[model samples]
Each structure stands twice: as C-alpha cells, then as structure tokens.
Target: MQVSTILLRMPNWLGDCVMTSCAIQKLRVTYPDARFILVGSKACEIYKADSLTCIIDESKTYPKTQRWHFKKQLVGLGVIAKIKAYILYSLKFWQRNRIYATYLLAKSIGKADLSFSFNNSFFGALFLCFTGSKIRVGFAKNARSALLTHALKLQDSHSMHQVQKYEFLIQDFIEPGLFAHILPLKLPQSTQSLLIDDKQHKHIGINPGAAFGSAKCWQKEYFIAVIEAFLDQGHYVYLFGTDSNLSWQITQGLRHMSITQQKNFINLTNKTNLTQLVDSIAALHLFITNDSGPMHIAAASSTPMISIFGPTDTSETCPWNEKIAKHYFCSHRESISKQSLVVESNIAILCKHLSCAPCKKRTCPLVHHNCMKEITPQEVLLIADSMLVS
Candidate 1:
C-alpha cells in the first residue's frame, strides 16, 4: 500500500489550485518518502517545493496550434481540394500533437506506483488512466468512475467548499482522524525581498477583476470609492489583477485620479505573476476583493480580507479563512429583509432581493446586474474600516 512514485494531476484554475495546497501538504505528510510528480497549469508553480520531484506545466506541454492559418493558406485551392486539404491537415495536426503529449506525459510519470487527479473532468480521468499507474484515484463523477482504480463519490451538496471536496479524493488512504488536522495553505517565503519605503503607512490591496466574468465584478466606481476611503485614512492601496482588458479599464480609471490620489494608489494589475502576487499580498495590512481567484490567494496568504459575493454561491466559494475574514453576500433569501443582516453567528448576508443572485451565469441573463449594482461602497468601506481598526 506504500506509494513510492506518485503522480498528482492538479486543478486548472488559479483559485482551485490555491485550494489544493492544503490537500497536497496532507499527502506529503501521509507519504513522507514518496516522490511527487505534479501535472498542472502555470498556477501550480506555487506548489513547487523541495518535495516535488517534477512539475509538468500543462499549458506549455500542449501548445495550441494555429488552425486558422492553415485554413487561410488553402483559400485559393478548389472547393474539393480545400476540403481534402483541411481533413488531411486536421488529422496530421492532432496525430502529431497527440504523439508529443503522450511522450511528455509518459516521461513525466514514468513507473509511477500511484496517480491522483484532483480535477473531476473526464479528460482528467483519461490523463490519469494514460499515466499507466498501478493505482489511479479520482472522483467518480463525469462517468470516469470506470477509469479510476479507486473512485470516490462526489459530495452531493453544492455548499461544500472546494478544499474539503478535494480531500475526499484521498480520505480512504490516510488514517481516520487525520482529516481534521490538514495543514493551512502557506506561500513559500520569497528569496528576493520586497522593497517598499513607506513602512509607516498601512497597505491595502484591492482586486476589481474576476476571471469568471463581469457578473461577479463590482462596479469600478465602487472600487474607486473604496480606494479613496483607504487613501483618506493615509493608507497605501495596491490594485491587483491579470493582464486583461477589464483590468486595463480599471487601471485607466485609477490613472485619471488626482495627483495626490495617484501617489497613494498603485495599480499592479497585469504586472505581477502568481508568485509575485503572493509576495505582494503578503505585504498587505488588509485586502478587499470580489469573489475572484485573488480573493482565494489572499485567503491562503492569511491576509485580513473582505470578499464581496454576488451571483456566485458564497457557501461554496467563500474564502477558506472566513473565521479570520468577513464576506458580504450580495444576496437575499425569501424571508430576509432587503438590508444586510447577520443570518448566522459569524456570516452576514447583504442585499435587496438577491433572489436573482447565485444565478451562476457568467453574464446576467436578464441584462441587469442589480445584484452587484445594489451593493453600495459605503457599506463595504464601513466594514473595511472596522476590520482595520480591530
């Protein structure tokens, strides 16, 4: 039952990858001597510790081909010839890529005793099967139960946090009582120190972009108001996000602020990578963000955060550090009043008729994002002020 060489297929998104850190730590402790091979996206770089023997960057491993270019090149050919050319090119393209991927995967997972896939997709199961490990473990959903040597049933409740859901994959292998003691997610200390001259002022990070879509994003004006509130308190504000068009729009809004406001605010959107983002967040006194990937990253960093939730289910994706942090749900249950209220001992539900929320739609199907729009900046700023003071 001892695993000598283990191949772990990680989740794809940045937030989910962050959540896997705790589970990975548990596995490492459970199999102290096992050699670990990680197959994941660029976000998985955060898990590259001494215990990891190899990391297969899934993004780089399967490079995307330019099928459009081939189509354009064959534009001058006869209709039949073009059709024939397209078919031939498509087959050759897939065959070549398949061979390369298979070779790389085989090399990465050579002679593995066990393989675990944290992803629940059919393709993830197929990847584990192709690794040729003697024992393959994964969730039994997506009709991939037959592919796994040991398949755990998916948790039925949508309220279960992803961290707990991932732990279900390896529960049978570890000791009975060890699940409750899973390690907290911790980022590796940076070798290169972050230099910031103003140590006197408190630093706050604001993330306005959500990778899921605009439906999860709060208004840019609301973000600006929050940033201004922090600046007024003589605190430094740092904006975090990826290099997307939406991030650029948010950055541009910040750029047009007064010279004094610009001096206190720093726009780091599109600039920092995952490692750098972790280091930058680690330097913060507080973080205010949407229910996005960076929100989860800040949670893992153990920063004091206030996550604004709209459209997405807070019970499922609320920051794992909810006890230490606070979340404002832009939603309302049937019996709750229109105003924000403490429904539970620690949790607060904020909104007017959030019946439209937890819609899970990337964009509002009704073309009205009232769920997010209804959340006022004053309420959020008030919460941030209280957390910072406490």
Candidate 2:
C-alpha cells in the first residue's frame, strides 16, 4: 500500500517543536517519500521547515498584540488602511488552506480516541479528522479519541521522556517498534563550520534559563559558583541564553570571580541560530542545563549532560538517551511536583540540609524562594567534577 500524505500538528513552543523532530524522524523512516506537512505556530517555522515540505503558520493568521506596538499611537487613515490590507491578505492565505483535512501531514491529528475536546483545545485533532485523511495519528487526551482512527494513549508526568513518549505514538503506524533505535539529528552545515575548539578546555556549557519561567531556573549564585569551580580547575565555560541581559550578567559575574586564569566564559546568547546553537552544544564535553529545549537538543545530539529539574517532572521530559543524560530529581516519585524538581539532590558532597525544600514557585509564591536559594553551587560543581574525570 502506498503512504500518501502526513500532516503533523506541532507543539506551540520552540522547544517542544524541536523535541518533536523525533516524530518526523520516525515518519521519514516509515514513509520515506510521502509528502510531509507541518502545521504549527509561526515561530516554529525556522525549526520545523527543514523537516517538512509544507508549513501552516498559525501565528501569522492569529496575530497577537505586540508590546512595543501597544505604546505607539494609532496612525492616520493611511496606516489603518495598510493594516487592514495586510490583515485581509493574511486571512485569504489562511482560508485557502483552512480546509484542514486536505493537509498533507494528517497522520496523527484525528481519531476521537485522542480527542482534544476534554482539554478544550482539540482543534488540531479536529482539523486532522475533518481533513479526511485515512491514516491519522495523535495522542488521545479526551473524548475526542472517537474521531481518531489511530490514537495512542497520551503519556503523563510519570511516563517516559517526551521524545520517547512521542516516538511511541508515531511508531504504531509503521513496522517494528518506535524508540527501538536512538533518534539522531543531523547538525546543519553552518553549525558544523562554527564548531568551538574544545581540545584543551574542560568545556562546560551552562544554560541558566527555562521557558517555564523563573520557578524552573536554578539559583544564579549557584551557577556562578559552578563557573568559578570550572575556572579553578583550569576549565573553560560556555554560557548560553536568548536574553542579552542574562548573558551580560553571567559574563560579568564570571569576570568578577576570584579565579587566577583569564576569563574563559564565552557568552553565545543571540549570537547563533538554532542550528549553530545545536552544533555548539554538541561540541561540548559536558552540558548542564535547566529543563529546557536545548537540553532536548543536546540529548538528540547525544551530548553527555546533567539536567537540573524544577517546575517539571524529569520522567516526562528528561533527555531521551539514557546513556548520555543523568537527571537529578529533587522530589520523590509520588510528590514530584515542579517544586520537587528544583530541590537539590542529596548526592554526597552535593548534599544540603533543608527539610522545607522544593517550594516550587515562579516568584517564590511566598516571596522567598529558599529551595533554589539553598541548592549551593558546590553541589552542581561536584557533578561537573565527576563528568570531567569521566
């Protein structure tokens, strides 16, 4: 039988979009020549376009108010006319492809079994179902499962990591099994060219931000402490983030540290594109990151890493490659709320004393975030020390 079309309803965020590349990989293996279409938010185009033939940018169609634009005064009739024209043009394009079912990548978005109705956001699944695809695939989160001809049980917090979990959903369509083999991401040529020379440096990559919000981030002081230790050991540190202010703060803190050697911290925030960023991460000997997108990227690239969990469960989102990732969960399996994720693990020298930990606050709901504050830099340094020795 010929596999004709595949439409994938991608996640809204950049990180999830990147992680879902595993699904695309499985699709390629099963339907090598089939038309692969991706329907996703506009921000996702840069990451998903390389993997799919067509893209439907939801952001362009559903425009959100811009913060900068809000302060500006509404211009004259001429400006209003241009805005209306643009809106009209975008609507036309959106409606042209609005039929939904004719979408090429309709593999897993249908099936009432994975209905989004319960979640009240099953529009993606509903679109796939109405698109009239024969083989639709998606996670059944609600009563909408009835619409899905091919639906997989949606994995929860205690389930396998996101990559593995999603692979299970798509693997049901093809032969053999999903996640039977490791998923590998090919580094872009641009990223290949910008590889850092890590021959001598005990290169450590630090990502100090999480998209989930500040609640997920480890303490800044702890990060600085870890960097200081790396320098003490004559190692080079690479700091990455999208925020310029954050990059500056990290670099400034490192420069001010009492290390004897010259500053070895390289801030690559806003400097590299997604591909280069991945390549840079892949080049690192060891990477320490919060539970974030690049963490998934590192896992996909097979880079050895230590992911600090907070505001999220590791079981559900930990890096897929077990051999390469060492996750440190702060909470027990049962009480594994976001707070439990950030409490420092009691791993020997990295241990701390605090019965009142894992507070799990975005801004310290109590106005004091002690859980993250108490997790000293020495704890993380100990882990990095082990990685360097290994």
Candidate 3:
C-alpha cells in the first residue's frame, strides 16, 4: 500500500528522542513526499525539519497516573512533604488536560495512512491501536503484539546502543541496505549570534543535574572540584542544569571566587529553554555531564563530552557518536559489558572498584552512592585535558 501520511510515535525521554533522529532522517529520505507527524514529548520538536505536520506532546496525551499515585503515597507517608506536594499539584494539572489532548491526538492519528511507534510501552501500542490506521507497526513488547498489525521482535542483546536499536526497527519498512547511510543529527543554525568574548578561550559546559534520579548524579562536591580545576587552568566554565534548586546550590559554591575566576564561570541553570540549550551547547569546547538527556543533546550537537555513568547500562544508552565522547562507568558490570563497544580512538571508559554498580535503582539501595563518590574529579580532569589537547 502506498503511504501518503506517516505518524511516528517518538520515544519519551529527551535522550531517546535525540537517538531516534538518525532513523527519522532515514524515513524522511525514503519517503520524501509523505507527510510526517511526530507524537512524543515537546522535546521531539527538535526534529521539526524531518516532520511535516505537527508534534503531539505525549505528557498531555498520556497522563502519568502511576507516578502520581506513587508520589501521593509518598506524601501521605510524610516523606519530603513540600517537594511531594509540588509534584502532586503538577501531576493533577496534567491529569486534567490529558483527556482533551488524547482526543486531539486520536483525531490527528485518524488522518494518517500508516503509523509507527518507536516506543516499546504497552501504552504506546494502545495509542497506535486507537489511531485505527489499519497499518500500525511497532515492536511486539509489553504484550502489545496484538495491537500492532506488524510487530517486530525486540532484540535480545544488550550490546547495541539505543540509536542502533531504533534503526533496526525502522529498517523493516525501508529498502534493504539503505538504513546504513542515514545522516547524523544536525540542529538548525542559530539566528542570533552567540555573545562570548574570545572564541579562542576553551568553554567547558558542566551539567550537574540528572532528571532520572540522584542515583545517576555524581556528587556535587566532585562537580565543584572539577569546576575549580578548570578555572585554575584558565578555562571558562558554563554550568547547565534544569533544576533551579540544584543550580542555585552550585552557583553559591562559586560565589566567593576572585573577579577573574568569577568572570570565567557562568551558571546557566534553569535559564534556557530546549532550543537555546542546544545553541549554547553548540558553542562549547567540551561538555561534562552525568547520564542525562542533555548528554545526548550535546553529543548530537557534535560537542566533545565526558559522560559520567552510574547504575544505567552504558552499552544501551551511551552517546551515539562514540568517537567524540568519553564514558566513565561507576560499576564493574558496566565497565566490563561496555568495554567491547567503546571506540578506542575517541572513547575511553573509566571505573572504580565497586561491587554494587549496575544496581539499576532510582536511588541507591544501600543508602550510599559510593559508585559515584569514588570517581575523583582530578582523574576526570586529567582525561579532559588529554581529550582537549588531542
């Protein structure tokens, strides 16, 4: 059947959405005339060039009732009341708007001739089913095989990165051997010129907050140490984070520096939106971050990066361009499992001795984040120096 309109259900997280860029680019190349509609988070707007119609915000379309319930239970237990209350209020707002958003999404989906879901969740499959597009395609996981007209089996190996996994799913629809040559992600050129003094000065971007959880975040003390080391070496530092409280804490730590040092450090936490964040990252000489969404965004921008990893599987979620970034693992399992996948020339893996790494917990199960603590800032700085020099 000739496909005139294609509706793609994009992955939820910003990092996952960035990883889907290559495959989405491939689909655009293969189906140049077909109209494309992307359904995912607002972050998916970054892929506006490849898409034709509009982006469906998943946060509105699929309300996070399970998370709301979990947090409400936490609030009842009197664990961090203030924070939980704020989160609960936000979730309630989303819940109120979800039905109307879902109605609009259903109406949009009904117009598509074919639908594809990059997401592996049962809810994603259900959304495709609701589209009633007859030609729904997606991975047959979460017991959603029945919902998809063409359900591909999930790959069993953990060796492949998420971007490659996305490509594997997209290959079924395209001609043989064409998926291998898809172009890498490139953001639109910035209209406003970047306001910086000297282009020759090395600008290092530091992202201290990880939205997934604190388990994925390295110690703030360690981040401060790295920032100090860079400033001492006459390098400019730009701290980036989405969390206002965390950003303020980091900013306060550097407030006592001399005027020279203060001038070299810039805190951009909670300041820029998604589009501006990309533009800012594109101007950086290097970006050092935890395993977060911006790490993938920086990687897609082709900015050199050093990503600190804990608990999460690096083999599954490492930056797509291995040749341009270094990944430091906190656990032995990640170091061992991800060693073979690392690009020897551009990528290096660092790990300290830890038995409980790859714990895969949102928060540390043992109440100690030794995995992230043991990795010293000096060690990271040495590697960063080498990467910059080379």
Candidate 4:
C-alpha cells in the first residue's frame, strides 16, 4: 500500500517510546509527507515538534502493562497471602468491561492507510484490530497474531536492542538502498551542544529518579555529591522528575532544600512535563542521569550526557545514536562493545560489569545492592567536567 496516513501505537513507558525513534525516523524518510497519528501518552506528545505528526493522548485510557510491570504485584506475596491482590490485578486485564471500553476507544481513532504497534500488550493488538486501518503490523506475541496483517515474532534469543527490533520490523517496509545515507535523527531544533547562560554560567540537568524501580537507580549520595560539585563549580543545576514528591525524596527534605536554594540550583522536578523536559534538557550544557525515561529524552535532545547504568542491560536500553548503531546494535551480540556509541564524541556511559548485574529486576535482590552503589560520584563529575567544556 502507498501509505499516506500512518497510525503508530507507541510503547507505554517513556524510554521504550523514545527507543522507537530510529525506526520511526526511517519510516518518516520512506514516507516523508505521510501524516503520522501517534496513539500514546505524554511521551508521544514530544512528536509535536515534528511537522507531520499528531498525537492521541491515551495516557489514562488503559492500564499500562509494559515490561511485565505486573511483577510488582507479585512481589513479597505468596500463593494464599494476597489472593485479593492477585484477583484484582488479573481482573484489570480480563474484565469484559475494560475489553469493551478498549474497543470503543480504538473505534474512535478512525482509519489510516497503515498502522503499527510497538506496544507489546494485548491492548496494543486489540487497538490495531478496531482501528480499521488498511494494513496492521505488530509483534505476534500474547496470542495477538490473528489480528495483525503482518505479525512479526519476538527475537528475544538474539538479545536485540529495542531499537534494532523496531528497525528490523521497519527494514522490510523501507525499500533497499532508498536513501543514500542513514543518519540518526535528533529531536527538532536540538544540536550536539552545550548551552551557556548569560555567556557565563553553564546549565546542567540531574535526574536522580528512575521510573522502572530502585534497582535501576544510582545511589542518592552520588547524585548529591555530583550536584554539590556542579554548584561549587558555579554551574546551574536543574533537577528533573515526574513529580514534586520525587524532588522531596531525592533532596531528603529541609536541610538539603536549603542547600539547593542557592541560585545555581533549580528544582524542576514537578515543574516540567515531558515536552517541557525535552526543551529543558536540550537547553542544558550537560545532563547527568540514571538509566531512566529522562535519560532517554536527554539523549534524544542531542544533549551531551553522562548516563549511569546498573541492573538494566545497557545493550537493551543505552542512549542510542547512529554511531552507537554501527558500533554495537548493528553488530553481533558476541562482539565486544568498545563503548564508542557517543554521538559527537562527547557522550559518557558508565556501567560496572558484575555477574549479578542486568538482572532486570525492579529491586536489588542482594544484601549490598552493590551494582548501583559501586558507581562513585568522582567518575560522574569527571565526565561532567568534559561535557560542560565541550
């Protein structure tokens, strides 16, 4: 089909949605004039910066089941101990009322020439079914194959980065050698850069929270130390997160609040929405982040960053760019990573290699939680110094 209007069902979480960009970039290149209608939450709204995209805010419509977040319900619960909890969680999916509601929601989106879902849930597949698109494409997981016109199998055994999985799906649709060169696309109006305030002070952003869970989070002491160092160096530090409560949690209340009250510190935790977060990160001289949603956004903004990693596999979810692609994602899984994914040669990635690392768990299951704790503040500050200057 000569697709003119494309409907995209985005991945639920912010990071996964951002990872879909490379494939989407290819899709856009293949059909530059296509009208892209995105079905997703706040993350999808970021696409507003693009000229040819519109978003449907389904952030509150259905339960998000990405990455098996249901595991949170199973935590610390035995077979008989939390039967009600189990039943309620199960009902959230299998309930007939919600199913019908999903159909209604899907039907309302109207039609498109082609529709593709990066979302892995049944809701994603079901949405495609009711959208009445000319062509439907999605992964054939969770028994949703019959609904999609093109159902690709999950390549879990290959350990492909989520970006690669999307690219592999998109490659068939993208004609062979259609474009002379494939380049990484950054967020609109962003450049590989450092922003100086008043031509004197450099602005930096710190996101101390990870939405996934504690296991993915770096220790607060390191964050505080890094923030302190930035302030001492006469740099403006902005704290970013989804809510103000996170600001309180990270700052640890009154004493720290007073310390951050200095003009160099701006607590933008509750202040910026996802769109605003993109703009803020793009404006910063440097961004220091844990492997989280904001980290992905900062990466997309083409902002220089030092991304810290722990339990989550960096292969699956590193801050990606075209160089990273040629260096790692495009290569065999067994090929050793030289860690040269840095765009503009200014990105820094810190991942401590431990046998127990990349467990992909929400919480550290061990005594020491050594994976996150071991990444010191000194290394982060060292990276910050270079990013600020560059």
- Candidate 4 ranges with C-alpha deviation above 4 Å: 57-96, 154-157, 178-182, 189-197, 252-261, 332-344
Q: Poorest 10 consecutive residues of model 2 by lDDT? A: 111-120
* Candidate 2 to native Cα RMSD, angstroms: 6.9
Model 1 lDDT per residue over 264-378, tens place: 8777877786667888887788888887777777777777777777787765676665332222321232322233433332223444448877788888888888888888998
Each model's lDDT comes to: 0.71, 0.58, 0.73, 0.73
Clashes found in each candidate (C-alpha, N, C closer than 3 A)? 0, 26, 0, 0
Off by over 4 Å in 2: 42-51, 54-56, 60-120, 142-157, 176-190, 193-195, 257-263, 322-371
Model 1: lDDT equals 0.71
Which regions of candidate 3 fall more than 4 Å away from where they truly are?
49-52, 58-103, 180-189, 192-197, 322-349
Per-residue CA lDDT of candidate 4, range 1-390, in tens?
677888888887888877888778888878888888888766777677676465564424444542146667668988886787667766655433446656766777788887898887887878888878868888888988988899998656346766777666666678767432345535554342322345577888888888888788788777887887777777788888764666775566324544534666777776765566777788878888888888877777777888888887777788876666566655353332234223335567788757887788899888577877877898778767767766
Q: Could you arrange the candidates by lDDT from highest to lowest?
A: 3, 4, 1, 2
**List of clashing residue pairs for candidate 3:** none
Query: What is candidate 4's TM-score against the reference?
Result: 0.82
Clashing pairs in 4: none
C-alpha root-mean-square deviation, each candidate: 5.4, 6.9, 8.1, 8.1
Q: TM-score for each prediction? A: 0.83, 0.71, 0.81, 0.82
In candidate 1, position 319 carries an lDDT of 66
Scanning candidate 1 in windows of ten residues, the lowest lDDT window is 324-333
Give the lowest summed-lDDT range of ten residues in model 3. Answer: 324-333
Residue 364 CA error for candidate 1 (Å)? Answer: 1.4
